[model samples]
Target: MTREELIKNIKSKQSFLCVGLDSDIKKLPAHLLSEPNSIFAFNKAIIDATAPYAVAYKPNMAFYESLGAQGWTALEETVSYIQNNYPDQFIIADAKRGDIGNTSTLYARSFFEHLGVDAITVAPYMGQDSVSPFLGYDSKWVVLLSLTSNKGSHDFQLTEDKNGKRLFENVIETSQQWASDKEMMYVVGATQGKMFADIRKIAP
Candidate 1:
């Protein structure tokens, strides 16, 4: 979806809610275990239940991928289901991928082309080339990992630069040069609270 379409969704729905389909097979309801394509079945239920309030669906790649080939097929089917049924809702693959040039390109193609998510969460630790491949797709987005909600986020993201700018701030500033706000978004955790104020200073 384009930036305008996403904005339109937010306005019409009056919500910016994003549903995360972190469906772990082990935690699924007992009855669902007996179903064929259990992963997709669980995701479809969640989507149907939450679609009214959510503007986007983000499927955590690791959870689905851990189950192997069948898991991957389920992920594809889940994405296609949303695409066909909710064309205006944005889809994000929470892959958090970052590697060298070639590896990144393949990842970009896998998520943005074949699997067909409108966006992918990416790790920027590998720098420009690692993240740029995702930016080349039209109307696609790169949700760069910045200040996370994890306990250890204070370790690196908080490091102060010579000019006293936080590492994540520098990341936000420099990366903004790579793409417009519509194509790029930083992952700012709600637990960060006031820190989001700081993020807006750079990202706004």
Candidate 2:
């Protein structure tokens, strides 16, 4: 959706909450496992219950990808359900995909064309070309993994360079040139706490 539309939703609902639907079949409700479309059933229930509070939903790709075809089918159904039932809610494919040019283009099409999510989490390790292909689609976005919440994030993201800028800072600074804020966002790890204030000044 366009930035204005997203803003209008947030203003109307007075919420910016994006629920993560990282549902695992093994951990789903005991009864849902027996349903013909167990994953989708559970997801539909989740969206129904949380719909009032959430403005977005993120379905982590690994959970569905692990089940192969069945998982993929469930994922597509989940996206369709959201689009039909709650058209205003933003959907993010938390796939964290990163690859070379041609492959990245295919990946973008798979998510934007096939699965139909509003955006996808992309690993920026492969740089601009990897993320830019996804931006080719109108009103779609690429959420670049910058300062992650994991402990390993400090290993590289916080490392100081010759110019004394931390790696994460550089990622935020350099990435803006690749796409405008309307088509791009940086993932500032939730664990960053106060650090988000800094990242916002750079990106916001």
Candidate 3:
């Protein structure tokens, strides 16, 4: 979806909540395990239960990848369920993937052409060439990991470079050169709440 469309949807729904679908078999309600397609069933239930309160659903890839082929099947089913049922809701594959140029193209195709998510979270540490491939798609987004939520985010992201710019700031600045504000977004963590205002200044 376009940026305006996403903004419009958020306004219409009066919510900006992105429900994280970190579904785990062990954590699922015990009753669901007995059913066929238990993972999809649980996801369906969760989506149905929470859809009213959220404008988007982010299915973290690790949860599905851990299940091997069955997990992938379940992930596909879950995505299909959303597309078929809740078409207006934005779907994000919270797959923090980034690699060399050729591989990144395949990664983009995997999420955009094949699975067709609205956005994917990606690491920016690999630099521009690795990131630009994902930004080439239409009506999709590349959410670059900037100042993250974890305690270790300071290890690199907060450190100053020779130019006196922090790594996260440099990420936000450099990634902008690759894509417009509409198609690009930095993953400024909620923990770094004050920094978002600063990011907006640079981003705007």
Candidate 4:
């Protein structure tokens, strides 16, 4: 979805809620376990229930990937269901995937062409080449990892260079040269708090 469409949806719905479908098989309700595809079944129910209040749905890849082929199938079905039934709602594959250029190209095709998600999370540590491939598709987004909420984020993201610029600050500033706000977004954690003030100064 384009940034305009997403913003319009948020206005029409009066909510910018993006629900995360991080459904784990082990955590599913006992009754859903008997379904032919329990993960998809659980996701379908959640989507139907939350679609009214949400403008987007994010499906975390790890939960499905761990299930192997069956999980992949479930992930596909869940995406298809949302596309068919909740066409206006944006879909994000919360797959923090980033690799070499060739591999990133395949990953881009897999998510943008095959699975057909609106966006996918990407790790920017591999630098621009690892992320540039994903930017080739129009309206498809590369949600680059920036300041994460995890404690370990400080291990790298907050590190300062000789010039005293923080790593996450550099990630946001440098990445802007590659794509406009329409096609790219930074994963600024809510826990980052005042750090968002710094991000806005550079990115806004």
Candidate 5:
């Protein structure tokens, strides 16, 4: 979706909430396990339950990947369900993929073409070349990982460079060169609330 569309949705919903659907098979409601499409069944119910309050739904890739082909099928069905039922809600594949040029292009095609998610989380540690492949799609988003909400984020993301800029500042600055704000967004952790001022300086 375009930046204006996303902003409009956020305003209309009065929410910026992106519900993370990192559903685990072991944690699913007791009865769903017997169904052939249990994962999708559970996801559809969760989506229905939370649809009123959420403007976006994020499915972490690992949970699905672990189940191999079955997990992938469920994920695909989940995306299709959201698109058909709640077309306005943004869908994100929290894959966190990062690779070299050619491989990154294939990865982008897989997510954008095959699975049809609205956005995908990418890693900027591979630099601009690894990220540009995903920006080739219109209205699709590349959410580059910047400051994370983990303890280890301080280890590198906060490390000062020779220019005195932190690593994440450089990630934000460099990745913007590959894509405009319309197709790009930085993942800032809620824990990094104070650093939002710094992030805005680069993004705004």
Candidate 6:
């Protein structure tokens, strides 16, 4: 989805909520276990209930990927269901995938062409070549990992260099050369607090 489309959805719904569909089969309610595809069934129920209040849905890929082919099938069904039923809602495959250029190209094709998600979280640790391939698709987004909320984020994201610029700051500045805000976004953790003001100085 384009930035304009996403913004419009938020306005129409009067919300900026992005529901995370981290549907772990093992954590599913016992009642749903009898369903032919429990994962998809669980996701459908959540999506239907939350669609009215949310503008976006983010399905963490690891949960489904761990289940093998069955999980993948459920994921496909979930995406299809949302596309057909809630077309206005932005769908994000929260797969923090990034690799060499050739591999990234395939990853891009799989998410953008095959699974047909609007955006995918990408690990920018591999640098621009690893991320550029995903930017080729119009209206598709590359949500780069920036300042994460994890405890380990301090290990790298906040580290400063000889020039005194923090790693996350450098990431935000350098990545802009690859794509504009229209097609790219950064994942800034809510816990970052005042650091968000710092990010906006560079990103905004």
Error of 4 at 92 (Å): 0.8
The deviation in Å at residue 136 for candidate 5 is: 1.8
| CA lDDT of every candidate | 0.91, 0.91, 0.90, 0.94, 0.91, 0.94
Model 2 misplaced regions, further than 4 Å = none
lDDT of 6 by residue, 74-117 (tens): 99999999999999999999999989778999999999999999
User: 144-170, model 2: which lDDT tens digit per residue?
Assistant: 999999999989999999988889888
TM-scores for all candidates: the values are 0.98, 0.97, 0.97, 0.98, 0.97, 0.98
Q: Name the lDDT value of residue 168 in candidate 5.
A: 95
Local accuracy of candidate 3 as per-residue lDDT tens digits, 145-204? 898999999899899988888888888888888889888887878899988777887887
The lDDT, on a scale of 0 to 1, for candidate 2 is 0.91
lDDT, candidate 5, 57-108, per-residue tens: 9999999999999999999999999999998899989999989789999999
- The worst-scoring run of ten residues by lDDT in candidate 6 lies at 188-197
Q: What residue pairs are clashing in model 5?
A: none
Total backbone clashes of model 6?
0
Q: Write the per-residue lDDT of candidate 4 for residues 1-204, one digit (tens) a residue.
A: 999999999999999799999999999999999999999999999999999999999999999999999999999999999999999999999999989778999999999999999999999998999899999698999999999999999999999999999999999999999999999998988889889789989988
The segments of candidate 5 whose C-alpha lies over 4 angstroms from its true place after superposition are none
Tell me the deviation in Å of residue 100 in model 3.
1.0
Question: What would you estimate as the lDDT of candidate 6?
Answer: 0.94
The stretch of ten residues in a row with the least summed lDDT in candidate 3 is: 195-204
- lDDT for position 124 in model 5: 83
For residues 22-103, write the lDDT of model 1, one tens digit per residue: 9999999999988889999999999999999999999999998899998998999999999999888899999999896889
